[model samples]
Target: MNTKLMGSALIISGTALGAGMLAIPMVLAQFGLLYGTLLMVLIWFGTTYSALLLLEATIKSGGGLGLNSIARKTLGKGGQLLTNGLLYALLICLLMAYILGAADLLVQAASALGLELTFMHSQIIFTLTTGVIVACGTGVIDKLNRLLFFVMLASLLMTLAVLLPEFSTDNLSQVSNSDHIGLIKTSAVLFTSFGFMVVIPSLVSYNSEASDKQLRNMVIVGSIIPLVCYLCWLFAVVGNLPAGQLKEFASVSELMAGFEHDAPWVGGFLSVFTGLALLTSFFGVAMSLFHQNSDTFNQNRVVTYVLTFVLPLVGAILAADQFLSVLAYAGIILVFLAVFVPLAMVYKLRLANALPERYTAEGGNVMMVFALLFGGFLLASQVI
Candidate 1:
């Protein structure tokens, strides 16, 4: 693989796997192993397809602009404003979610070492760590992400390997009542889980020199890693937990805590891995948000720095206890902005240009309609 391709893959993979991994097992556990794994795959496809749609839109529009610019071009000024607002809100929510998760991990680590700290103190530490990383600039974040991505993959594999022996086929048979509710309720978690798709356009814009085939390949390869990781994680946790207990623990930390009680090293290792995963995500979002904000305000570094660093930390502190709930709620808005709207743009472009040679939609109107309907249904269900 080309060096740039490798770097892009790491960036994409790291961005996708962040924070979501920590919550996947618990989300999947709600619906049992088999069903949850299947749901995850469905989510992966939906998210990936949406991302491709966005990429197609980006390509047709000349490919340099970020999502906000594309939305403005396709949707007009009002549309642009709405999209920008949604993007900002979504980024803020994501920032808060990551910070909150990091703070929780730090607190857990401190508690494990017999040093009890208040949530605020932990939040401060988490914020500062993230701020320092952000302040170091994109080059530093990119470099760190490259190394951390490998460490993250290794830690994930190692943790999964240790838990594999304990996997139970009987647990896979158990199904969550929520799955019967169809994609609606399931989408709450799925949309949020797959929200990283929003970063795809940004990724494409960054790796502008990459060939079309290379971009597609990178996306496929990048997306698959997370799908496999999510499946393994679901298998490990869902198979290990009893059906009744699974409902009580809506967060992955609880499941990992159970594992930790039985296997301290495994739990500790996973916890650290989980923290790094969130950090990687935080870095990506911070970079993207900073870049977008900077571009919007005509590259005002001060505004970018302050918004990137401060907003998330404040949101995190305010939402320390309700981190997961906030994530679930944010999923509703994100599914529309991240998935639905972009799909529509792609479809519209496909029709306007009769099968254009470069960066065209694959299945024509049929695929476009499907993307629209599916994305719309997800958005509507969440609202109702």
Candidate 2:
């Protein structure tokens, strides 16, 4: 594989594998492993297709613009304004979720080592420690993100090794009759779990010389890796605990506590994996948010960094207990950016005959209609 392609794919995997991975089990517990897995596969396909749609629009506009610019070019000022607003809202929700998660992990780590720390202290420590790398700009984030991605994978494998032995077929056999309602409730967060499309424009800008094929490969490979990982995670969790026990976990800390109680040895590996997942995901979202601010403001770098991190940091602090809620809301905003915005741009391009000749997203007008209906279903699911 090209090194650039590998690095870029890691970015998408890293971003997609974050807080939503932590939150999925919470929503899926009542939904059962069989139904949850099917719903996830559906979402994976929907999100991956939407990402390719974004790629087509980006390529058509000459391949170096942000979503805001792409929206303006393809859909006019009204489109730009809507895209800009949704982009900021989505990024902030993601950052806030990550901050709260990392802080909880920090507190857990401190507790294991026989130290006590307040959530506020942990939030400050996590935000500043990771926030510095984000502030240093894309090169630093890219390098650190790649390194952490590998380390996170190592921890995931180790954690899985411990959990898979305890897996039972009986645990996986349970079914919920309300599977359809469960799918409706969980669709938003599940879709958000695959919400790496926000970084597609950044990937295009970072690899300016990358051919259209390479960009599409980045989205596909990057996203598919996380799909596999998430399934593995869901299997391990469901196979061990059964639906009733899984339903008791309201937060990541509680989930870790359940593992610790059942198999004491798994806690260490799971903690390491969870912490790395939060960090890698944080870098991807924060970097893209930083770039969006920099481009929009064209201000001093310090000012852009502040604009990117400050609001989310404060939101995280105030709502430290609301980790799952924040992720659920981010899923709502993600529907706008990931599905509707890209669908609109590509639809407009096709009507104008402005789509690039060499590399268009597959599936044609039929796919566009599917995307429209899918986006509406997710939005209505979350809202209703």
Candidate 3:
């Protein structure tokens, strides 16, 4: 009911749904339904805990410092440099990944409507769309993002409803191809799925007036929505496709291509859904980058808009054909900053003081450290 609560919900949901939703079925099909579903729960909670730990650290450092500031305070100059470099890289790569995805989706949507366009044309259109939105400013971006979020949610639910009746329980039992190694690698998808946790500190600092209890409840409830959506989505997608088909497609677009051949209208609708989802996601990350860099760049709105949009557009153009690969790269970088960095910040904060007596996790710093290490291990395993 609180406006801040609503904002937090949007932030969490917006972050959670991003391009990750589109990849769930493909990822799960490799690992099967049960193992994949269980892994999703584990990763979701781990990401949620990591987010809370980051928030606790943010609160301790007077609540206004972004990831860079916290890193500097807790981890010193080296930490600050590492954090800034990683965050900048992650944000840029993430922006490029989503932009390329959006371009691809636009190309798909146009083809569905009998409008043929080349990938380069689609890239130009997407770049322009993003640039216009960024130029309009953050308030406009936020409002559009919320509306697009609902569109994505409705589309996901609608597709699930149609696919539910066709779900096969037997299909859910298909085993992962890579066995243990494959499962761990697939978990990379789940881990980076929650990479938006970086935005929590910004959300908390912006809504500084929110009570500790309210913030905690907001994070829990906000996170649950996406986790549930992912589970439902996984069930529908993995249930609908055969194990053999899933392995052939490295990304969701490839999977949806099959759906397009069988169910043209549903696939067309999904193309639109995928496009909007990626657009809103790009908007969120771009806005965050804009805000993060605004203070450093003379507070000039035009300059901020240009740097945020143009630089990423160039990166996206360079990565036009490698959308999924770019996403994989971004995921690895995000794992380091989103998981390990936050965990370290929480530990440092705890040792410095007593967490302000109102913002301590259960079991104090011990549990927090273990959680971080566990998440770190999961993330590291993916790279090795």
Highest-TM-score candidate: 2
User: Per-residue CA lDDT of candidate 3, range 1-384, in tens?
Assistant: 486567656767776677777766666677677678777888888878777777777777766425666777778899878888898888888887777777777777788689998877787778766767766755565577778878878887777766666678887787756486677676666776666666676677666788877777777777888888878877777777787787677654686886766555567567656776677667667666776666335467777777767777788887766766776777778777877887777777767775567676556767776786766767766776
lDDT per residue as tens, model 2, 1-384: 588778989999999999977888778856777778888998999999999999999889775435777878888999888989999999999999999999999998998789999999998888877877888866676777889899988988998889877778787876543658656888988998998988888888888887888888888999999999999898888787867777767788999888877788899888988998988889889888887887677788778877988899999999978988898899999998999999988888888888457568988889988899889989888766
TM-score of each: 0.92, 0.96, 0.91
Where does the lowest 10-residue lDDT sum fall in candidate 3?
290-299
The lDDT of each candidate is 0.72, 0.85, 0.72
Which residue pairs overlap in candidate 3's backbone? none
Question: Predicted candidate 1: what Cα RMSD to the true structure?
Answer: 2.3
- Give the best candidate by lDDT: 2
Q: Lowest summed lDDT over 10 consecutive residues: which window, candidate 2?
A: 174-183
Residues 1-384, candidate 1, lDDT per residue (tens digit)? Answer: 686677766776777776677666555576666566666777788777777777777777665435677876677788778878888888888888887777778878898799989878988887776776766665577688889988888888888777777767787777656554653465666667666665666677767888777887777777787778777776777776666566666554676777866556688669867888888878777777776776577655666677677777777777766766777777777877877778767766766873377676467778777777777767765666
Q: Where does candidate 1 clash, by residue pair?
A: none
Root-mean-square deviation per candidate: 2.3, 1.5, 2.3
How much is the lDDT of residue 264 in candidate 1?
65
